[model samples]
Target chain A: MRGRRAFFGFLGKEVRHILRDWQTLLVLIGMPVAQVVLFGYAVRSDIRGINLAIVAPQPDAATASLASRFMDATDTYRVVASVADAASLEPQFRDGRVRQALMLPSGLAGALGRGEPVTIAVVTDGADPNTGSLMEASTLAIVRAWDAGRTGRRAGPRIDVETRMRFNPTLESVNLFVPGLIAYVLTIVSALMTAITIVREKEIGTMEMLLASPLRPYQIVLGKVAPYVALGFLDVVLVLVAARLIFGVPVRGSNALMLAESLLYILTALGMGIVISTSTSTQRVAMMAALAGTMLPTLLLSGFIFPVSAMPWPLQAASNVVPARWFVVITRGVMLKGAGLADLWRETLILAGFTAALFVVGIRRLAVRLA
Target chain B: MKAATREPAGVGSGAAHPATNVGAAVQARGLTKRFGSVLALDHVSFEVAPGELFGFIGPDGAGKTTLFRLLTSLYLPDEGESRVIGHDPATDMWALRRRLGYMPGRFSLYPDLTVIENLQFYASVFDTTVAAQMDTIEPIWRQLAPFAGRRAAALSGGMKQKLALCCALVHSPSILFLDEPTTGVDAVSRREFWDLLARLREGGMTMLVSTPYMDEASRCDRVALMQQGRILRIDRPSAVRAAFPRPLLAVTAAGEGAAVRIGLLAALREHPDAASVWPFGSTLHFTDRRAGPDPARLATELGEWLAARGIAATVRPISATIEDAFMWDMTSAEPAA
Candidate 1:
């Protein structure tokens, strides 16, 4: 163990660096808040209006009028353009003018009048998997409603599945994503940013000057870890404040719990940073590794954006290793549901384990790598 | 000569002051180091007393930096052992670290921090504050104090070097390791910086500096001539110059036919008495093969040969320099010149 006086002394200097360079701290906190606000107001799961296209080739008065009812009724769908045949469908899809296309085959109205089986082909673009899935589901619901009205049926389909989006009853994308984005950006800036910084110093020879001093390796490590932690904590508060003021989002969880979770999350983040710093010999390598390692999973596999439950088993397993995944869970449990420690015990333990393991690995890496 | 003998009490010790004594600032034995396949130091052995200005003189890859690293405890020697101020670099590194200062070739001080801040930070790292060292670093600090608040990155190369020096000195260590400290500095700054080192010697601080500059090597109490990871020679600067085995001659010509005259003088190497001839300036620097070249005949013969080439010149003997010894040592094919 390092002497407390030296460790705390070095830690104090690091804190001084953090306080002086407050801009980095601001960015750390502000990023999550802004992301949350942007997602909350501008995105939603239950969309009001989606651009829809139709091709009713019969061109009869009743057919065209009924199609008009589907578009104008309750504002569920907005008619973008009408095509003549299957040939026009491809052109419309390629041009990106239509998300989902409706095709009522010839004599579709006569079949429907005779109560014969009538089915409308709903062709949807599969490029944007999220919106494409939404478009497909929403179009099916609207067409079913029209069929139900014609049959004079009051009862709906069996097995009424109710999805209650936790933390965000409205299923706002920002509400689900803002906290995770905060973790991502802060991790990038703190871990990856500072990792390259150490290599840069070593390259220029300043590390030699520092290493030659009486300060122990642990003292040096403490000094580096201290400043970034304060910055990370401050960033959490900044984003939270901005998120509430700008996006009308409230912290449902206790602020203290949120802070404690953030501290653990940053510990994991900074540990990875030290490992990276010790391994790399140059700033370029550090930057490349930092950017690629921090950005990818935070966006794709963290359950911050795409639901982890819906992801492939392998990807879900991979997400289990990513620190951001645990952080998002902790954030939602603490911030949205206002849950205490019990609600996040498992995730909290995982995060603590990651922090401890990374720290051990980082220290071992320093010992093996430096001299 | 008498004034030269009255050396400062804590400065350069007596002749044969190369022992790695108990109180010695630095000690190394058979210190061999290799970077990958490249042998940086081979069986290197040397010592610096408590207050000696020792220098490592050689070409770029002559293992100067490797030796410096071993001394500063930045590198662990592959073969030999080193004790800095009685602390084994391989084991008691943390303890050794407190008593030694190091300045690398490039400026490593934090660019974002001011000069004063950098000095203060380094000072506090050793459990001492900057205020206490203000008296010790007053001279160097006075030069940099005016712009102490500015970021170190924006300072001129010379100023940056000075600030780096100040930070290294702020802790007031027992020994200092400077690896090519003045390689990129200006001549004026180099002189001023060495002056500071001399003053530190006055206060009893051992310094081991490495440089490729032969001119600067002359100012050291003793220097080690290294090449290919081995020490070729180690002695006082004056002795190294004196030990050159050949008598030297200096020549000059300020006329338009100087090149023609220099060309003919080079042709003297074919003569029985002429050992080697090299161009130093407008004229040729020549050395006698044996001893006592007939000056009258040599001058007359060279004058006639120059006249044949429509050239005019003058020649006379001059003192040998450290560069001459280095050049002679590098190319064994060339007879002693």
Candidate 2:
């Protein structure tokens, strides 16, 4: 008998085994989708509803209007404290009553009447840098708007420049996590399934039967991995659909390109699984190796939760070996940046090279073990 | 003459090969294997002719399963050469795999798949469907047909062995290697399983079976008595029994009680010339240090010796079996000497 028919027969049997076992089937689809939704909701980097403290040493009509303007304008800030002295700002901040404090010096209306510029101090908590920066920006916008209305004339040498955000104009964190989630989901599902499938055969004593057959080692590996490629892609589609429906994360680029890139990443992950399974004998060991060797590195180093650039130089260098890192970049580029293949050829090429390397090494190890 | 006249088929010897010799289904020369610090198989050598049902009979830890694994191409030997079905298992693994059927010692079939599904999968993996080879496995499958839908793990031990045999035979392999196929089976099933092997042998299927049950040695065409990673002797069962060099005696306690039997066994071991004594069922088998120890005189003296101890008993000269030979060989360093 030729190899192709036997290969397909083996693949069909594997698919049957997977489908017959309910626990394995559930884990295959459940873990990835849950992660996508969980990371999207719980790990967002957006801030809202900041508390404001206004310290007016001298109470006047200008300070009163300033306080009303902040409340009536946007939901970004609420006036939670009104103190008579600037010294009271310390306890307001220390007691968690306010995230930002505005200090208006004495005779603020008199200074404006004399045509002198008054310095209004704005101090914000710097514990959470993102929220702090956002508060500072909103505060300056409110102060400048009030001053512009009071003078009714242009400030010195003011230049009007328009800044526009492309792709994700709303800056929703889900848009970022959804693409990274695709890489993550495909990485874990493909690698884990591929790793455990071969080791399961080894554990059951079927591997000896397989090796004794005419099927080559490479044929056995390819057959075992072929079903998971399809399953992983199905998972990719499921995650993408869930993200779009639940979180409104848009896929602005070519959907075909995103799927194609995800498929490439899945192949890389499956290759990693083969490498893991060949080096280990039992399913327990293979699963541990897959989780520790592939999944954790993918989660930490792929810039999924933490940005890669903020990592130290040595860790940044080590992140290059992680396939998920490259895939994350490619997915984000295609989905969020609406980038084309031409723009992402470098990342795509790096992923292709890494996949080929892993596959070659894995197949070589499998062949050696079979021999 | 047996080796010279055996190759009428010329199946595995189309070419003049160094590793393969003509006529034999399997041939090994000085095969040695090791597992870390333990020497599993040490300098073992043997041959199985075409259509010969060869048995490796020994206690546990004898190199039977290790030799089986090596010959089946599931493992490589550290220090020797072997040819299975006309090719070196080390180099021609795939070529040899096409012609071999291997059932490992453990219950290694897929626990998740049903009995029938397991059979089908094994067949399909060898590029042959179960239906195509139905005639070959019909006997085993018929017994397993009633529990076809049950998972392999849920089957009884006897049924699991039958299912494993069916899967191994479903590919219609030319040579079969069964490692301890009857180890955990019931006595009736074990007998029936050997009957199946005999039938397969009659159909001209070469088989190598291993077992720890010494009684099953008489069922094989030839047997290799193995102990401690070495072959003590390899010959026909009758030859092995005849080669036991000492005079044997059987002593039975007249009173049918466990206490009397135990006292008899202990009393016989105290005899001056008794080299070894082991209880077989209700009777005790004893061997003398000398080859021709005057059977009647020894029996009377042993009877008198037990009578003096107030343990009534009867003693008689008896023929030795493979188990007796094995026991004698295990107790004494030299059997043939």
Candidate 3:
């Protein structure tokens, strides 16, 4: 209990410094807002006509009208140029005027009317896979819809599987990002700030005063970690509030479970901060290690933007070791799935185990230094 | 606090008895610390006797702080043994930590906590209370009681130092290690600070303080002059002065320019027995060579030589201080051309 009080005592002091500092406040609050707004509008999964060029070779009124109908349904996207044959599709696609080119053979319409097999070629640029996938999917849906209206049904039986993106029906970008953002902001600011702060004390000569006291070296290390863990929790509160107020992000999971998982995460993050502190001697080096080493991976590989399952196997495996990755999953499962502790008990235990392990490692490093 | 010319055997308070000798309270043999490829300390052997105001005087990068950290168990020496208060620092670090007080150079107390809170934080960690340390830290804490409510970071450098000293003393440790405690403080603060240290040293608390300031060397009972990770000499400041191995002459000119140029150079050439010619201030200092050298004759000959060069300067013999000893060690690190 005295250690708890000592812990809170350290935590309070750390919070005081962070609240009073202006630059850190700016970074913590400003970055999330900017990133959320930037990603929200810039990223989309559906594509329409998308600069379509028809290299039909033989133009028909029906084909031209079909292209017009396709553009009209997909909002703003339209057919930009009409070519005489398949030869023109390559040049138009390569010059970047179109995302894809539609090539229809001379007898394509006749074959479709006669119920004969008709093939249409869709040539695409594969540089951006996500964009390419979206373009291909949307175009196929439009063509299928058009064919269905012409004939009552296709020769082969078709089945529709209605998909609903739970919690985020429209798949809003902010909803997808809210939980990831919380983990990232908390992990980075908490781990980095405390780590650099302790190292800075050593550089300036203040660490000697702490070392001289009856305060065990581990106690000193804890005293430094305690304050930032509280700070990390405070950032979590800010993120939850901001997510709701700014982006309508729902917190569907159990509130207590969220807080508990977050506390475990804070422990791991603070442990990381302590590890970094013991390794570096200057504020500059500590800050670099914290930001470059921790923040970047949390943001990029934690399924914050690109889905981890969708990422290549190596990156997904690499993400497993990052504490932030677990935190993000916990955040999303709770915030979006409304999942209880029972649903995420395995993840929670892993986090608990991780925090304990890192704490032990950090304490051991401090002990070695003291010894 | 005594403002006497000569420091007594005892320090301020809680000092060890005057009977103990070097490293009796703290001892290290074959002590070495390697960080990757660079050796911060190499087989350094030293001791802090009980109740002695021992100082480790060295320039920046002289491994004073590293040695201090090793003594406090903030670092593990790779190849040597260290004992503090008869306890092996590596094995008995926790117990040793509970007995020793360390004051690092910077003001490391909680900047946001009230001065009392910072003291209490440290006290409580050791499982003691502020009431327990009233005797040990009262002399220093009295100065800070008025501003106990203020944050530690907001305090002036001198006040902060006093607060830090109070915090270190509150736990009542037997030995203390202060690493560059006076750095970044003003002159008045530095003098006042050393006075406080002298008072603490009198209490019979063994102290191993490292300082770059040469003036503070005189206030210590004994000093270890260090440079480039090696001890040049360790003795009483007076004794270190006595062992310079050559006579030192001071030269001054009425005109500052002539004193620096003609006087120092003329003195150098006029006496081929000159071991070293260094600019101490406005005038240059000429030290003796092993070959026979005369300060009086050298001054006269140097005066005529400078006159021939159209520069008039005064050259005379002067007392050597620890700074001379320090420069001697600094030059030792460098090879002669």
Q: lDDT per residue, candidate 1, A299-337, as tens digits? A: 778887788887889999999998999899889878778
Q: Which predicted model would earn the best DockQ?
A: 2
> Of the pair 2 and 3, which is ahead by TM-score?
2
TM-score of chain A of each: 0.73, 0.80, 0.74
Q: Which portions of model 1 miss their true places by more than 4 Å? A: A1-48, A51-76, A79-125, A136-169, A367-371, B1-23, B256-284, B291-311, B333-337
Arranged by DockQ with the best first, the candidates are 2, 1, 3
lDDT of 2 at B331: 55
Query: DockQ score for model 3, please?
Result: 0.36
Q: What is the TM-score of chain B alone in each candidate?
A: 0.84, 0.90, 0.86
DockQ values per model:
0.36, 0.45, 0.36
Consecutive 10-residue window with the lowest summed lDDT within model 1 chain A: A155-164
Q: What share of the true interface contacts does each candidate keep?
A: 0.56, 0.54, 0.56
Clashing pairs in 2: none
Model 2 agreement with the true structure over B61-91: per-residue lDDT tens digits = 8889889888988788999898888889888
Which is the better candidate, 1 or 3, if ranked by lDDT?
A: 1
lDDT of 1 at B290: 52
lDDT of 2 by residue, A118-198 (tens): 788888988887567556656766676677787633331131211212344334668878887887778778998799999
